[model samples]
Target: MLAHQQQHAVSQADLSVLSLLTQDQAPSPAQVASSSSARGQPHASTHRSKTKKGDGRADVDPLLIAAAAASGPDVTRNHYFHSFFPHPLAYSACDDERAALNASPPGPSTSPPAQRPKMESRQAPRSIRLQVEEEEKRRLERLERLRREQMQKEEEQKGVLQDKPQAVALPTRDGGFDFQEDGKVQAQASQRDADRIKAPKPGQVRHLQDDSLVVLLRQPSTPPPLEHPLAEPPFPTVGAQSAVKPESPLSAPEPTAAASPEARTPLPPLEVQCRVRTRIPTPHGHIFLHLYTNNHDTKEHLAFVADHAQMASTSLTTNAVEGTPILAETGERRLLPFIRSHSLDCKWHDGETDQERIVRGAYVGRLTETTHIASHPNPHSLDPTATPPHVHRSHRTTHNTSSQAPTDPPLVRIHSECFTGETIGSQRCDCGEQLDEAFRLITLAGRGVIVYLRQEGRGIGLLEKMRAYNLQDLGHDTVTANLMLGHGADMRTYGIAGAILRDLGVAHNGVRLLTNNPDKIKQIEGEGVKVVERVAMVPRSWVLAEEEAAAAARRAARKAKGKVSGGDKRKSLDASIASLQSLDASSRRPSDSRSTSLASSAGPSGYSSRAPSDIDGELSDGDSDSSDWDAKTDSSRAYHLRRAGVGMIGASVTSSPELDKYLRTKIDRMGHLLNHPTQQGTLKRVMSSGGASTPGATHQHPLSESVTSLDGSSGEAASR
Candidate 1:
């Protein structure tokens, strides 16, 4: 009975499961719970509800719940609503499955329909294509016609088919008959037949269409006779010409002149014209600045003429109320020829008026608003026999001025442009100072000329000159720097300068050239401008040094004399007065060996031999005590005042290491005729106990000693 009962229970469980499976709708939770309750078992729904109640959580994943909780209260259940939808990856999976299902062999229903044929069988006939084809056809036809005409012209020019008419057959794309004259057709046929028969064989000579007689594989044959036997050969043959003119066999053939290397055609002569001239009143004196244009170069070179004749006359006339002489008896005005530009004085055109001439600076005497006198044109002004219109009677004075006094030649300085030194006041070169000194000297001399050439950096332009400055900063000398930049050491040329000098009528007589460069002298002399004397241009620093040394010596002499007199106050004052007189006299005299000896004596015991530090201390002491010198005698005070005034004038350039290096390079390498301070034993003790002073030790050099003394003395004079 127990076995039967277990079997019946098993059969009933099987029947329930079968009935549930056979039902159309799945059983709900209520039905499942009822069935379980009836069977005396725990309902699945009840167990699930107990589990959910005990866990106290929704059906959400624990990770998602934790994420939501950590996201803060801003994230609610709505934030996770997107998770309920299908994941993008799941959609991709569905797409992949669909693609796989579709990837199987296509059935009739899924196959793509066949594309219908295009309405136009081929590509649509484009008008542009038709136009292009027509144009190409016309171009080909034109080319063929041109070719036929060219062939016909060539044959006629060659005289090969002079009587035959050329019949050109036009090319046809379609098979078509071409109309032609029967005679032309027959002629072409005959010509073709002749060519076929007359073609040259392997061993025969073939004559080219062009008149060349080239021999082939066999021995050369005589050329066929010309159609016109009397015609002259196109080119003359040397043998035939020589045969025509027979020479004596005994006499050597006339030697033909062979070209010599030195036989070069000379360059055209350089011509220059003075375009304008104007009187410029400078600090020194009045100068006539003449601008010149030359054929050799486009640069407008300048000439600064300090004409004593004109300047003296003007000055005398201006101060005539004071009864000054119209012409001074200095003999400079008579000896020096009047410097005038020939080209400027010449009439520019036939219709030119005196106002035009005066406006262009072609006038005689001083040009003033009240007095405007245009000079007469004198084309032969430069000729020896011709006299310039501007030359006055004072210039023609035959007082034998040359014999009365030895006339110093008119000073001339050929100055090349130095933008760095002149315009910017650079001390690397003494160019600006030299220019200023030149003006001062020329003004004092009463007659001179300054030809200013526009050759900056010795013909290298300003840009290259700046580049050379950088090169010089790299421990190279000026010459080496120029050479490194593919330039000559000095590429300056004086041709324009010479031309300008000639135009001014100053080069006829020799000039006393103010320059330290021997090369400039040689070059100017080569231009047919005579340089009778070369005036050395000593630096102003050196001049100031010499003056200071002399002054120092006079002071020392006074002091020593005071000591010899046993501190007698009156005797010392007397000695000081005498020394002051001597100083005045010496200062008035021109510099000579006496001044040089004084400088040498002062060099050993004065600033030149002293170290820079010692000089500085002495300068300080002098500055402190300068106030006491005011109580000295009037003569002594006057002497100091004069020296102080001179000091201010020569204080433009202060001594520095760069200036020293530049001077050294110019002296040692550039062949400039300047004396170094150390060599002269003047100022600046550049050489120490050793043979040469070190470049790095600038403080040891006494270059600033002279400068300091001058400054202190000037300051004392100012305080007084």
Candidate 2:
């Protein structure tokens, strides 16, 4: 009867707890195990020790009562396990059976039973699968016993749910492993909160536990809030952060993204300013080039202003009150942009006028002829002699200065300076030809601009260019030499050129540019200035000489071949020598009396090519017909023919095979735009020339500034 009554009470308790569990947890294996284990939460040994005690209806739950006094060992007073099973009758049973358990111990112990820990503050969840399984097995035994009790006493179960026992004394919470109500409340509250939150956010790799995914991967947090109570952040400190002010790898500030020169760097802007505008009179025209200095490097650069004679007084007049020059600084012109590039000290006022800030000069025309003048400095003294520009300030020696500037876009050329080519007769390059051609074309057209940058040797300067020349002679090209010298292939920048154009006020309409380089076109045509037309400057002399040389070589080759096939070895040499001699006579022998008379006039002049009429090299061979040129061998004759052709008309006596090689390098290596029509030209030209059908990179036309840059060779030249 006692066993039946005990079974009945246990049946009522089991049903109540199952009903409290959520419906989702009913099927979850882990949750089922945890909840099922709640019955024997204190110990797994209670149910195991009770084995062989009948699994029938006679059995009573050990956890339902406080102890087993008659049939088995007494239940331990574990405060933590009692908290989980909070049924009121369970406490009364403990009070009712405590006296009985004391009289008879649960086991034969030599010493008192060990006291289990009651509460724990979890920083992280512990693996409790074994604890769960142990409790689950014990619960199943109790559940089986309850099921049989329900089967036998189904009618008795109705009143057990209504009955309750009075509340008993509960244990106080000690913050440590002593008993606690708060920890149990906190754990339940936290578990409920976790149930509401089902899954992690997208792409996050965190687990649903107290432990972190990767503690080492934690990065630096943002600065502490200004109003934070503690000076240090409230976050849990790791490593040496607590004792010492520490800097961690995780707490270091992230570096900004700046990985490229073009993106990350801010380059100093380009600049060109008009320092002074001076008038220089020449036989072709009066060139009034504007002088300027740059901020990027120390170099005195200039540009020729077109048709600016009327504006001369702006440069020369001495205004007593103005104090500053009108050309660069005058009347509080502080906002000028070029002033900053050159790093000039100036300031701009808020109410500055556009007109006051604007810098203006004069324009020249391409059609006008510049007045030619001569001023000998006593041929020995420093002071300039009596001249129109130097003698009297007011008197002007102008050439058609009355003519208006051209309505069309002004012609423009961006010429890099070359001292050797311009000062002396340096035919190693065509810098002289280019300078003359630019001046001639612009002056002939009457209105144009030429920004003469003092960029000697493509901006490497005079000394480096000479070194580059030595390197070139040692067999490296101009492009590679610059690289070997730690410079780019072409270091010239058109930024200043563009800026000067905008300052000149002539850029708004457009510009007629003179150049063969396609790169020049892209850079110069910007802002208000558009390249409306393109004009080419050609060296007719070089092209003609190259053609003459090719023709003479072919004739010598043909004559030698025909005579050698006749089987007379002596005749072969004779024919080859005869052929070369014939060419020498025909070219050197004056066809007219004027040729003989004009021999002196045909003498070598300065590097500057004479005007458009005398574009050909004026050959000045005095009465010497030497036999050394036409040697008695085919190879010898061919060599003579090549030399004769190059030096025939307009070539200087100094023009040798080295001169030809130097020039070929200019066209090929330095990328000079001029072309030489010779087999001895650039290897690029020779390979491209497939014999008697290919055209040259540039060709000469009587009046045309147009030349097709074809790489193929044309048929050998012929003389009239």
Candidate 3:
């Protein structure tokens, strides 16, 4: 520290002396060098060597030589070295006095390397040492302050523990709330009180006597109100912890007086009431119509009215001149009250004009069911001026302003002729019976049109069907026989049906199907018509059993072919056609001579309904056709068995007592046939004898036993 101070002082002194030396003007180098050479000092040569760059190897002190030549000794000597050395020190210090200068090194050159040891030699003064000691003492005081602050914090925590018994129950001593254990809180409180007594000195206790204990008492803890009182606390509903203070509104008590009856005793459901209305038309003459209103939407509430005997409400008004209540002489007014009550906006006078659109000269009038309000025909209503059929098709595209397409015409099954089962009682199939059923349903609906196609035997012609029958007799199945007759298994198509539907304007909304055949459904559907509903057309009693058996067998065969047909799939279309043919024959006979002759022949006498003579005896021509009796018998038998099987199964066991009896009889007969002892014996013998049967032993078949087992009587079995 001294050396540093001395160096600083010397630097200030040097600046002062240097300022004095530089006060006069200095001499030039040439003169200074000349004088220095004259001096002959060995250091003069060193000077020359050092400062000879501008003077060419000359040890010349130009300033000194100039001063000497100018006759100034002091000026010459002083100028020489003064010009050569650094300012201030150069002038004040003796040029040959190196020892003192070396002793006290120049300010700039006095480094720590030289002064460090000297500094270490002196002991520091007591005042500085005392200052350091005081500083250390202040630091120690600060540390004590922090310690005291920390201790006070701990004391405050201890006081909190004393106030709140649960404070010390926590696992952590860091003073967080603890809910993990019991009893620890009370124990902690007692310990805190004891610690308090231990913590204060006698003097502190005296001061404490002056302090109020109430001011130190802990504040009571209260929870904030819940945001949603109806909601449970943060715990599972099933847990025991879920039950908290009665703050939840859901947990509030309820009054029993205001509770509903459902809360006490539940009652049976009340019957619902619905309103339904049906517009029925009768054909007793003059368009007679009546609306039937009921609480149920069922056909039983809507009775069938004969065609041309009734007229439903139309969008147009009925002519008042026609008569009040649109009465018909032959019609009854039983449903008038219901109609008047349910009708909406009905009109008494019809203002319809004949200028409207027409199909084949027949006016296409819209019949409004509820209100008899009709809209004037649009400018392009069917366009009768053009081709009626095409115009109708076009009109369908725009009939309803809001509808996607025109309403579809009712589905019509234009079934073709089948002579054997249909006309003649050739009931190998159900052609006759199914035809009858179709006619009945269509006539009942009163909105369907059946186009009778002439395509018989699936377009192979009736003769071929007979031929196919011969093949079938030769062991060919129905499909195989048809295929063998130089035709597809089914050659019929729906081209004519399509044309008929088109003519009838049914290409839009869709048609209600009356068939179980998926093929027929697909065929019509594929022809741009929707199949809304399917009405099953089953056959009559005689061929009814045959129809069912054939259907089931066909279904079985189809199923065995690895395809499923509930006898409803299109795969059974051929079977359906057969059924349809049976229906048509039984229902619609061409009012021609052929049907008349057959009807006359079956009208009693002339051996019309004769009983079966024998097992193979010919049936009287009256009841059934005798032309193909052999083939008919097989087909009829198949049909009868199938129909009966399906019918028996379909009949409700508990509901239909008569049907139940019939089914029971059938089941018994089937069981007898299946479990007949002779048949079983024959089968066993055949198996044992390498699949060969007795040649001419009359087969030794127990005919009476078989017959008795089948139907409990030989005569019954033979007759069947």
Candidate number achieving the greatest lDDT relative to the actual structure: 1
The superposed Cα distance between candidate 3 and the true structure at residue 76, in angstroms, equals 99
Instruction: Return the TM-score for each candidate structure.
Output: 0.45, 0.34, 0.26
| lDDT of every model, 2 decimals | 0.48, 0.38, 0.33
Winner on TM-score (1 vs 3): 1
Pick by TM-score: 2 or 3, better one: 2
lDDT tens per residue, model 3, 1-720: 743343233233233323333444454455345434434445533433444354344433445345443432234333644434333333323444344457766577654332111113376799998999999999999999999986786577446434442211222222212221231434444453445434544334322231212222222111122122222222111111110112223223342211222333221211111111233232111221222221111111111222221134231222222211321222332111101111111111232112111111111122332122222233123222211222221222333324223322343454656666566545365455445444334443333444444557755568878897787677655555654544444455443344334434443444454442334444555455545543333223312233234345655775587745445443343453443333323222212211011110110110111112111121212113233443546544533333233222122011123323322322232111111113122211110111222222112222111111111112233334
lDDT of 3: 0.33
| lDDT assessment of candidate 1 | 0.48
Candidate topping TM-score: 1
Model 2, 1-720: lDDT tens digits are 754443334432344344434232223444334444655454333344334245554433433322222111212445325655432222334543455446655577575433333456564444576777779999999999998975555334223212211111111221101111221323332443243233434543332221211111131112112121222222111110010111232224332112112332233344444544455664346666676654444566777754432222221111212311222111231111111111111112222111111111111111112211111112112211101111111111122313322233556788888877766646665566566556644554344667787767765578878887787778766566655655445555565566566544345345656665444555555333456544444343443443345446655775676534435544644564443333322221222211011000111221112221221111111101223333434533433342343322222232445456755555554334444555564311211123212124222211112222221111121100
Clashing pairs in 1: none
**Model 2 vs. true fold: TM:** 0.34
Clashes per candidate (backbone, < 3 Å): 0, 21, 58
lDDT of 2 at 177: 13
